[model samples]
Target chain A: MATVEELKLRIRELENELIKSKQKQSDAEHHLRPKIDKMSAEVVDSNPYSRLMALKRMGIVQDYELLLFDYDKVELANMNRLFFQPHQAGLSKVEAAEHTLRNINPDVAFETHNYNITTMDNFTHFMNRISHGGLEEGKPVDLVLSCVDNFEARMAINTACNELGQIWMESGVSENAVSGHIQLIIPGETACFACAPPLVVAANIDEKTLKRDGVCAASLPTTMGVVAGLLVQNVLKYLLGFGTVSYYLGYNAMQDFFPSMAMKANPQCDDRHCRRQQDEYKKKEVERPKQEVVQEEEEVVHEDNEWGIELVSEVSEAELQDASGPVPDLPEGITVAYTIPEKDGASGETVEETDQSLEELMAQMRKM
Target chain B: MATVEELKLRIRELENELIKSKQKQSDAEHHLRPKIDKMSAEVVDSNPYSRLMALKRMGIVQDYELLLFDYDKVELANMNRLFFQPHQAGLSKVEAAEHTLRNINPDVAFETHNYNITTMDNFTHFMNRISHGGLEEGKPVDLVLSCVDNFEARMAINTACNELGQIWMESGVSENAVSGHIQLIIPGETACFACAPPLVVAANIDEKTLKRDGVCAASLPTTMGVVAGLLVQNVLKYLLGFGTVSYYLGYNAMQDFFPSMAMKANPQCDDRHCRRQQDEYKKKEVERPKQEVVQEEEEVVHEDNEWGIELVSEVSEAELQDASGPVPDLPEGITVAYTIPEKDGASGETVEETDQSLEELMAQMRKM
Candidate 1:
C-alpha cells in the first residue's frame, strides 16, 4: 500500500498534466465550434439540407408521433389587409402566409379563409362548428393553432384562443381529446406591447420611422421571415414534442427589436393578456390551476444542513456563520426572478403590482 | 381601422381561425422535419463545404489537443501517466490531438505532461514551485486549470448516454486561492467539477460481446469514446467561454445482480484516476493501490435547479417532507444531494444538510 503522502504527490503531478492537455483542446474548440455554427448558417443560406443542429445539444432527438393533419386548399388562412403576393401580384406577407400554408405538410390539414367579419362570439361559434365538423368526421385533432402579425390582431387571437384552450382543457374532445393548447400565438406569448423584452427585437427608432410607423411599423424581410419561419419552427417542434421551443419571440419596430427574446423557463408575471384571458375564461368554475402534476426535474441540495439553490443574497451570510473556512455550496429554494417588464402603458393596463408573489401571479392566470 | 371591441373581436376571430391553422403547422412539421433532418445528415455525412463544413461536422477528425505535451516537455509533470492517449496507441489520437493543437490562434501555448494527478501534498508543492518559476522566469501564468472529461466520455455505447451525461467538476479555478496544509490551490475563472456536475462514466456490459468474448465482458469503446469526446468538448468549451456548459448530466446504471450500481455526480468526487501502473511516474502513483472509482454508466436523473444534481437518501423522514419535492435552487450555503441509496462498496462521503424552508420546495422544484 502506498502512503497517503505518495498519493497526494502523484495527484499533483496529474493536475499539472491535465491543465496543459486542456490548452490544446481549448484552441481547437474555441476556433472550431464557432465555425461549425457559421457552417450551419451557410447550409441554411445555400445548401439544400435544412435540418439545423439540435437546440440544446442533448444528443438524441426522439420525435413523438403526432396526430398530423392537412388543410391547405380547404382551410387557407390570412388577414387580407396584410397579405402580400410576392409570387402573386407581388409577393406580399399575406401571400407568404398563404405560401407557408400551401407548403406545410403532414397527412391531415385544415382550411382557413380569406374573408372575415369579427367578434370573439362569432369566431367561437365558427370554431365550435368546425371543431364539431372535425369530430363528427371522426378525425383526431390534438391542437388548434394560428399565426398572425404584430399588435393589431392578437387580442382577438387570445380571446378566440382562451375559449378554445378552455374547451380543450374542460369540455375537451368529449371522446378523444388532446390535453393542452399551444399558442404559436407569437405576440400573445411574448406578453403585451409594454411587456415585450429588449432581447427579442431591437427596433430602429429614427424620428421618421417612429413618427411614420409608430407601434405598427413595417417589419423587415429577414425579421418577418424569422417570424413566419419561427411559426413553422414552433409548430414543428412543440406539439408532438420532438424538439424544444423557447416560450417567446418578438420583433420590435420602435425598439428595432426582431427575434430579440430570451427563454424564461417558467415565468410568473400577471401580465394584462394572461390576466385578462384567465378572468374571461373562468366565469363558472375557477379552481387552482394544476401547477405541477409531477416533480419531473428537481434535485435536492442539502449542504451544511441547508436545502437548495444558491440565492444571490445568502453567500456572505452563510460564509460568516462558518469561520472554519471554505463554504462548500449554496442554500436551496432560492431562485432569481427573470421577468423583464414589458411596456406597461401609463394608466393603460390592469393592476401592475411589482410585488406579486408567484402563487398570486399564477392565480391571476388561472382565473382565465 | 378597427374598434377596441372590434379589435378584440378580430383578435378572437383570428385566435379561433388560427387554431386549426396552428395545428396544421404542427402536423406539417412532423411530416417534413424528418425528411429535412435526413437530408441535412446526408449533407453533413457527404461533407459539402470542402474544408469548412467538413471541419465543422467531422470536428477535427481525431485531433486530441492534449497530445502535444510529451513526457519530456512539461517540467513539473509526471511523464509516465499522461492524461490520456488513445487506447489503440501508435495510432493517430496523438496526431489528432496535435493537429488540432497547431491550428489554434492562442497568444501562447504552454505544454506539459501528466499534470492532473489529484492529491493534497503534490498539489501544494507544484503550486509553490510554479509560482516560484513564474517569479524567477518573469512570466506568470494567470490560470491553473484541471480540465477533466466532457460529456462525450460519460456516454455509453448504443443505449445509455441518450440521457446520462459525462463531465466532472470538482475544484474550480477561482481568483480566490483555496489553500490548506499541503494544498494551496488557487482557482481561476474556469469552473471546477464543483461548479459543473461531475461526469459519471460506468462500465457498459456488452451482451453480444459478452457471449462471444465471454468473461472479457467490458469492451465498450463507443461508451468510453463518448465520455472521452464530451470530455474534450467541455475542455475546449471551458477554455473559451463562448458556449453553454450544462451544469449536470447524470446516470445510474442498472446492474444484472441483486444490487445495482450508480455512476453519478457528487460535489466532492474529483476525477483522480483509481490508479494502476505504466511508466516511471506511474511507479509512485500506480503502485499506490487505488480505490475503484466506478466501472459502469448506470441510470441517473440530472436536476438543473440549484438543488443537487444527484439525489440521495441521507435526509431522514422529517427531512423527506422537505426533501420529497424539488429542492430549492442551491443557495451559497447549501449542498444538494441526489436522494438515492449508497453504491456497492463506497462509504462515508459526508453530506451537508440544506436549511431551505419547505415552502420554497413546494413552490419551485417540488411543485407538489
Candidate 2:
C-alpha cells in the first residue's frame, strides 16, 4: 500500500500521460486522415473523400480519388470557372485547388508543380521528376493533360509527351469564348500538335500578339468548365475503359455544334520527335499479330419480304458526288470549312485511313 | 473665454464621437462596399469585382456588375461541381457562393431565396416580390434564370414567367450527368416550358424518385460551369444585342455534340397562359407590316460550268420524302432522334412552322 501523498503524485503523472496520448491522436488525425486506408464513400461530414468516393459509389470511376492536377495561379477570372474562392484570391491556384480537392477526398494523392510548362527544361524536369516513381516501372504518369493557353506551352507539352512516348490530351477554348476543343494524343499513334499546327500558328500569328493594347480575349467560365468536364470525362473513360473516347472533339457554343475527326501523325511534322513517333508506330504495327476483322453484316431481320418492294437509297452516286463539294447557302450566322490550314511542304491528306486501320487492329487484339 | 476644464471636456467628447464614427465606417464597409459606384476593373485586392469588370474591358458586357444571381444551400457533394471551398463545407450554399461571388465582384447584385422553387405559392410570391421593382411600370425583370433541379420547379417557374410575361432561361443536366442544355425563353415570343415538356416529365415520373437507395447522380463541376457560362453569354447577348444567341443549345459531352433546335409557342399548349401568348403573337403579326422576302436567285456567276458539266441537286423530292421517315443504321454510339416524348393529350406536332414565320417577321420588323 502506498501513502496518500505518493498515490496523489502517481494520479497526476497518469493524467499527464493521458493528455499527451490525446494530443498524439489528434495530430495523427490532422496529418493522416486517409493515409491509413482506401477512400470510403461514407456520407458523413468526417469523411473528407465523400464527394470523390461518391463517384465510385455512382459507378463512374473504378478507383476513386486518384487524379493528378497541375494548376499554377488562380486569377480573378478563374473564379467563375474553377472552385477557387474569394478568400483564396491571391494564393497559388495549385494550393487552392488542392486544398479544396483534399477537403473533397483526402485519399487522392495530389502533387503540384507551379513551373512554366512552356520552357523545354522545365517541361522535361516536370515530366521526369513528377513521374519518377511510375516512369521507373515502365509506365509514365497514366495520362498527361495539357490545358495550357499559349502555343509554346502546348508545343512544349507535345514534345515532352512525344519524347516519353506517353499518352496525353489537349484542350483549348477560342478567344471569342464561344468555342473549345479537346483532342487525344497517343504519342506515335495519333497526330501530335506539330503534326498539323492550329490555324493561328498556320496563319503565322502569335495568339498572345492578337490581343490589342487594353483588350483581352473574352473568356467564359462556362466554356472552360465544359472543356474541363469533357476532358475529365474522357480521362475517366480511358482509365476505366467504358465509353467510346473521341479522338478529337470540338465545341461551337454559339450553334452548339460538336464536330469530331481523327488526324494522322504528319510524316513531315515540324517536330522531329513526332516523325520518330510515327516511324515507331509503323514498326510496332508490323510486329503485332495479324488482327481479326469483324465484318459488319448487313442483316435484314425482316427477311420474309412482306412488301416485295425494292426501295432505292435516298442518296445516289451522283448525289453523293455532288455532296462531296463544299455546301453553299449555309444558314445565316453559319460558316463552313473552318479548318486548320495545311503546313508548307506537307501532303494534303494521307495516312488517316491507315491510322484508323491500325486502331481497328489494336482493338481486335484487345478483344482476343 | 471658456474655462480650461470645459474645453478639455469638449475635446474628450469629440474624441469619443470620432471613435464611434470610425466604428460605423468600418461596419458600413463590411456590409456595403459596392453600393457606392459602378464596377471598376482595377487590379487590386481591395477591388472585389475586378474579374467581372475585366469582361467589360474585354468588351463582352456593357455592365459587368449588374447581373443578379440566386443561390441556396451548399452541400459536400456540390464541392465537385461548384465553387464550394473547404471552409464553406457546412455553410448554406447561397451564403458560400455569395461570399465568393461578392469577393469576385462586389458590384454584382446577389439576392438569396432559399425556399423551394417548386412550391407554387412560394415561387409566385418570390417572383412577384423580387420583380416588383422592375414590373411596376410594365417592364418585367431583365431576366430570370431557373437553375432548379426538378420538373416541378421548372413548371412553377414557367407558370410564373408566363403569368408575368417575363423572359427567363432554363438550364438542366441529364440524369447520367454527361449531358446538359440551356434555352432562352422570351415568354410570349418563344416557346414556354409547357409547350414541350421534357421526356422525363412527359413520362410522368418524379425526378426525386429516380434516385435509388444510397445512390446519387454523378455530376461534374465542368458541365455546370459550361452551362452557366453559356447562360451568361446569352444573357449578355440579349442585354447588349451583340452576338446571335441560340434559342436552344444542347451539350452531349460523350460525343462532344451540340444539337440545336428552335421551338415555337404551342397554340394548344396545356398551359392556358401559353395559348394566350400564342394568340397575342398571331395578333401582333397581323398588325405588323409585311416582311420583305429575299428570294434566293439561281445566278451562276460563271457563264460556262467550270467542269463543262451540269451538277444536279442532291436533295430531290423523293429523297426529302424518304428522309422524313425514321432513319435506320445510324453511326454507332450516335442516337438519331432524341425527341421529347409527348405528354398525354399533347399533339404529335403542330404550330412550329407558324412560330418560325412569326420569328422571321419579327426579325424583319427589327431590321426595318
Candidate 3:
C-alpha cells in the first residue's frame, strides 16, 4: 500500500488535472461564441434575437426595452425554476439577470437596481425612476410589472403606482404551488392592491406571524413558469395594443380551471393617494373626447338575384355595442365585479346594487 | 502618431488580455458550484432541488425521473427561449438539455437519444428503448412525451405508441406563434394522431411544399414558454395522479382563450396498429373488475327539533353520477367530440350523433 503522504500528493495531482480540463472546456466555449453588438433578424443559426425581432416585423410590438430590480442574491433553489444558474449563486439576482439578458440581446439597454423598494430611500428613487425613466427622458414609463412575493413589497408597489397614477400588473403563484394569478392594476380605474386588502391584512393580523420556524412554503417550476409566461404575454398585449388585456386571470392546476373577473376600485379605499388618483381619473374621463361612429354601406353580394333573397345582420346594433364598447370607465371585456364594503358601517350604501349587477352579469354569461 | 504595425501589436495584446480575463472568470464560476451527488429536500440556499423534492413531501408526486430525446443541435437563435444557453450553441440539443437537467437535480437518472426517430432503423431502436427503458429494467417507460415539430416525427411517435399501447402527450405551437395546444393520447382509448389528420394532411398535400426559401416561421418566447409550461404541468399531473388530466387543451394568446375538448378513437383509423390496439383495449375493458359503490348513512343534524324540519340534498343521485362517473371506455372529463369522416363513405353511421353530443355539451357549458 502507498504511504499517506504519497496518497495525498496523488490526490493533489488529480485535482490539478481536473482543474486544467475544466479550464480547457471553458476556453473552448468562450472561443465558440462571440458577443454581437446589435440585434439582428437574420434567419441564421447565429442570430440570438432573430425570433424576438420577428415580433416587430410582424407588427406585434413597436419596440422593446428591459429593466431589472431585485433586493436578493441568486440562490441554488432558484435553479428549479428558470433563469438563474448554479454558478451564479453568490451574485445579486439583478446583476445575474442583467448579465444573462445582455448576452441574449445586447441591443436592448439595461438598468438594474439592487436595493429594497420597500425602504424609504429606495421607494423615493423607485418613484422617481417610474416618473421619468422612459426612452425619452422626463417622460413616465409605459407600464410597470410587479412580480414580488411578499405582501409588504406588493403594498409598496401599490402605494407608488397609486400616487403616480401609473398602470401596472401583478402576478403571484400560490404557496401550495398548484395555482397562480395575474391581475392588472390601472391605479384609480381598477382596484389597487390597497383598495382590497387580503383577508389576513383585513383581519389586522401580522403577516410575519404566519411564518413558522424550520418550515418553508412549497413551490414548483411548472406553476412559476406558467405564471411568468402569462404575465409576459399580457404585458406584450397591453404594450402592442393587439389583444384583449385581461383585468384579472387566475389558473387552477388541480382541475385545469381558469377563473377571470374584473374588480372595481373601492370609493372608500383606505389609501388617500388611491382616492386622489380616482378623482383625477374621473376628471380625465369627463374631459376625454367621445369616439365617432362611422357607418359603412352594405355590400351587395348578388347584384342581380333571381330569388330576391335579402341578407340581414342577426345581431342588433345595441347588442353589438354592448359586446364591443368600453364600459363607463373601464375597458371592453372588463366589467365591475363588486366594490369593497366600508368598515365601521360609515357608508350606508345598499350593497344590493353592486350585488345585483354582478349577478346579472353572471346570469348573462350563463345564458351565452 | 503610432505606426500601423504598432497599432496592430497593441490590438493583439488587448485581445490576449481579454482571453485571460474570460478564463479567470470561468474558473471562478466553476469553483463556486461543485457538483452535488444527491438531491436534498432541505429548504436551504444551496439545495437546487429543494423546491422540486418538496412535491414528494406535499404528496403530489411519488417520484420523478427524466429522459430526453432530440436530434437538432443548439443554435444561438434558441437563446430567445429558455433552457439553452449561448455557450451551448454548437452542442446537440439532447446533450445540452441533459447537462442542464443533471445540474439542476443530480439524483435523477437520464438517458438521452440524439438521432431522428422517424427513420426505419432508428424507429425500431426508439420503440425498443420505450418498451424497456424504465427505472426497473425490462419494463416500458411510464409515459412518452412528444415535443417534435414535424409531422413525420409526430407520426413516427404516434405509430410506435399505438403499436406498443403506450400513453403519450403531444404539444405544438402555431406557425404564427400566437397559439398552442396539448393533447393526451392513451393509445386506442383516445384519438391517435393518425385517426384525425390535419386539414392539409387530409387533403394529401406535401408538408414540405408549405415551406418557402429565405423565409422562416414566426416564433415568440412567451408563446413557447407558455406551451412548455402547460405541457410539463400536464405531464406532472399525469405522472403524479393529482389533477384532472385534460384530453385536449388549446390556448389562443390573442384572446387569452383556453378551449378544452376530448376526442374518441376513430373506428376507421388509417393506422392498422391503432385499430389493433383499440380491439385490445376493448377486450381489456371487459376483463377489468367493476368498482363497488359504498353507501353512507346520512347524519341527523336536528335530532331534538320539535318543529320536525329536515334538510335534504337538492342534487339527485343520477345527476351526481352523471357529473362524476367515468364514460364506458374513457376517464371523467373526457367526452367524445367527433370522429373523422370516412374517405370512401364505407361506414353508414350518421355524423349527427357526434355533432349533437358536442352541441349538448356546449349548451351545458353555456348554462353553467
Candidate 4:
C-alpha cells in the first residue's frame, strides 16, 4: 500500500500534469511543453520508422510536406533511440537533426548559430564550398537547386550558384524584403524568380513586414526548412536523376509557416519540338516541356517586357507538332510561355510575375 | 502638361515622404496600427498618450508601466437610445434616467432600477438575476464594442490593487463574458469563481474554445464592464506602473489609450517600498494586514504567461511589514517569522509570500 506521502506525491504529480495539460488555461508564466508519455495508445505503440514508411510508401514525399509528431502522448525517452536523437541524444542540434533525418529525411538542417547574419559570412562561405564543390572532376552537370531568405542572402546565393552552376528557388519570405536568410545556387532548371514575374512580392510586401518577416527572436528552422529542403531535394534529383524533377516548389511558408509543396512548371520551355515528341509518347493531347509553363497562373500570357516567352494555350497539340510558323525572333538566352488568356488580342496583353531580375526591375522602376 | 486623368487616378497618394527613411534591423513581427495620417512613420509608432504629452509638456513620461491593448479594436457609436433592435447599442437605466431628466449636475437627479450591491441579499439577487437571465438586460451601457473578426480575442489585465467596488464605468466594449468576439468580464477580485465563474450552462458551448480554455464561456456584464475599460487601465498601471499615479490630463480617452497621471512617486515610494523601511517594518508586522498587503501587491502586478515569473529577493514592502519575529502568537493569516535571509539559508526555501486563507487563495488560483 502506498503511504500518504506517496499518495500525496502522486496527487501532486497528477496536478502538475494537469497544469501542463491545461497549458492554454494556465496563467503561470512558463513555456508549455506537452507531456510526451502516457497520453494515448496510438502514439505510444507507433515507432518513427512506421511514420517515415507511411509517408514514403504513399509516394507523396514531395518537398515541403510537413509531418508534425505530436509528442504529447508517449514517453519520448523510451523511443528516443528509435525515433529521435539516434546520432546525439543530448545536444539540441544533434537531437533535432537526428529526429528530422529519421522521420522526414529533412533535407535542410538548421543550425541556430545565434550569430549576426551581417558578419556571419564565414560559415555561409564554408556551406557554399561544401554544396558546390563537386566530388567529381571535369564533367560537371547542369545545376544545383538553392534558395535564400532575402536580397543580401540572394546576392550571396546567386554569386555561389553562378560558381557552382546552380539555380536558386525564390521565396515569398523574401517578398517581405528581409535581408537575413540566404540560399545557394542550382543550375539547368530555370530559377523561381527567373520564371515568375514577382507576383508574391507585389501581393505581400506589407509595410509592417517590409524589413523583417516575424518576431525579433524569430528562428528560421521550423518554417523555411521546406524551401531549403526542397532546394536540397532538387539538388539530389538533378544529381541522381530522380523520378520527376519539380523546378519550382510553390510553397507559401508565410500563409501557415508549414512547409508544404506545390509544383510550378517552368515558363520558358517554348521549343515546340520538346512538346511534340513528349505528347506523342506520353499520349497527352499536348505536353508543354517543363520549362515552358506560365510562371504564375494570374499573369497575362503576354507582357510588355515579354522576356522571350509565348502563351502555353491558344496553340493546339497539332499546332505544336506542326512546328511550321516562323519562330518569333526572340531574345538569345531564355524563353517561356504563359497559358493565361490576354484581354485584348492575345499577342499584345502583358503580365508581371513574382520572379524578377530585381536589379533590372529596380532600375526600370527607378527610372519611372 | 500633365493631364487631369493622371492626377484623378491617385488613391491615397503621398509624396516621397512616405518612403522608409532608413532600414530598421530588428526581427519581431511587431503588430500594430497607427493613425492613417501617420502611415509615413515606422510600422509601430507610440500609442501612449501620456508619453506624447510628457514629450510635449516635459519631454518624457518617465514611469514604468505595463502595456495592454486588444488585437480587436472595435468602432463604437454611442447615444442615450435603448437598443430596441435585439442587436443594437444603447444606454443603461441610470444613463436613460439621466438623459430623460436632462439633469444638469450629474448626481443631482437619479432614479435607478438597478439594485445596489451594498447589501449581501441584494448583491446575490442581482447576480442570480443577471446569470439566470443570461446577463443581457437589454439595458445598454454607453457603448457596445463588437468584434468584427470571428477570432475570439483575449485580454488579461492586472491592477496592483485588490479591493474593487461595484464596477460603475462606461466601456467602449461590453463585458459579462458572453460567448462573442468581445466578452468583457471582471477578473478575480469581484464576483470570483465562488460567485460568478465563467460557465456556459445556458448557452451552446463552443467545444473548441472550451477545449482551449477548459471552461465554458459564461459571464456577467457587471464583471465585464467593470473589468473592461476601468479595470484594463488599472491593469496597465499595475503592470507598467513603475512609479505612482498623478501624471496628466490626456487624463482619459482624450489621450487615446494614454495614462493621464501615475508616473512619479514621492522620492520615498518605490513599489516594493523602500527596502530599509521594510526591514524595520517586518520585525513588528501583524497578520491580517499583511495578507491585505499581499493582495494589493498582486493587484498591481500584471503579467502574461509568456515568460516565467521569477520571484526572488522578492519580499514586497507590504510583506516586510509583518516583521515581528520569534514565537509570536500570530493570527490565521501570517504568523511565522520567515525572513528571506539577506544571506543564504536552507536548500528548499521557497520565496516568502502571503499566507492567506486557502479558499481565498484558491479563488485567486482559478484565474491562473
True contacts kept of each: 0.00, 0.12, 0.35, 0.00
What's the ranking of the predictions by DockQ, best on top? 3, 2, 1, 4
In model 2, which runs have C-alpha deviations exceeding 4 angstroms? A1-82, A130-139, A199-215, A293-368, B1-36, B39-72, B133-139, B199-213, B292-368
Tens-digit lDDT track of model 2 for B139-245? 35577887866677789888887877778889987544556788888666667787666444544556565545554444555566667666766665565443446
Question: What are the per-residue Cα lDDT tens digits for candidate 1 across A14-68?
Answer: 5554455455434323322111112131212111112122111212223222222
Separate clash counts for every candidate: 150, 7, 0, 74
Backbone-clash count (model 4): 74
TM-score of 4: 0.23
Candidate 3 residues B206-270, lDDT tens each? 66776655455667788888888899988877665555567777777765666666666766778
Candidate-wise lDDT, in order: 0.26, 0.55, 0.65, 0.26
lDDT of 1 at A91: 30
Pairwise lDDT winner, candidates 1 and 3:
3
Model 2 chain A weakest lDDT span, ten residues long: A294-303
Each model's DockQ?
A: 0.01, 0.09, 0.18, 0.01
What's the C-alpha lDDT at position A18 in model 4?
47
**Who is ahead in lDDT, 1 or 2?**
2
lDDT of 4 by residue, B1-368 (tens): 43344433321122121221111111111211122322111222122121122112111223221111122111111110111111111234344334322211122223233434334565454334333332234321211122211211111111111022111111222111211111222223221111211222112234244332211122222222222323323322323332221111111110011111111111122222222333433443444377687666544322222222111111233433433233233221121211212223221211122244323332332322
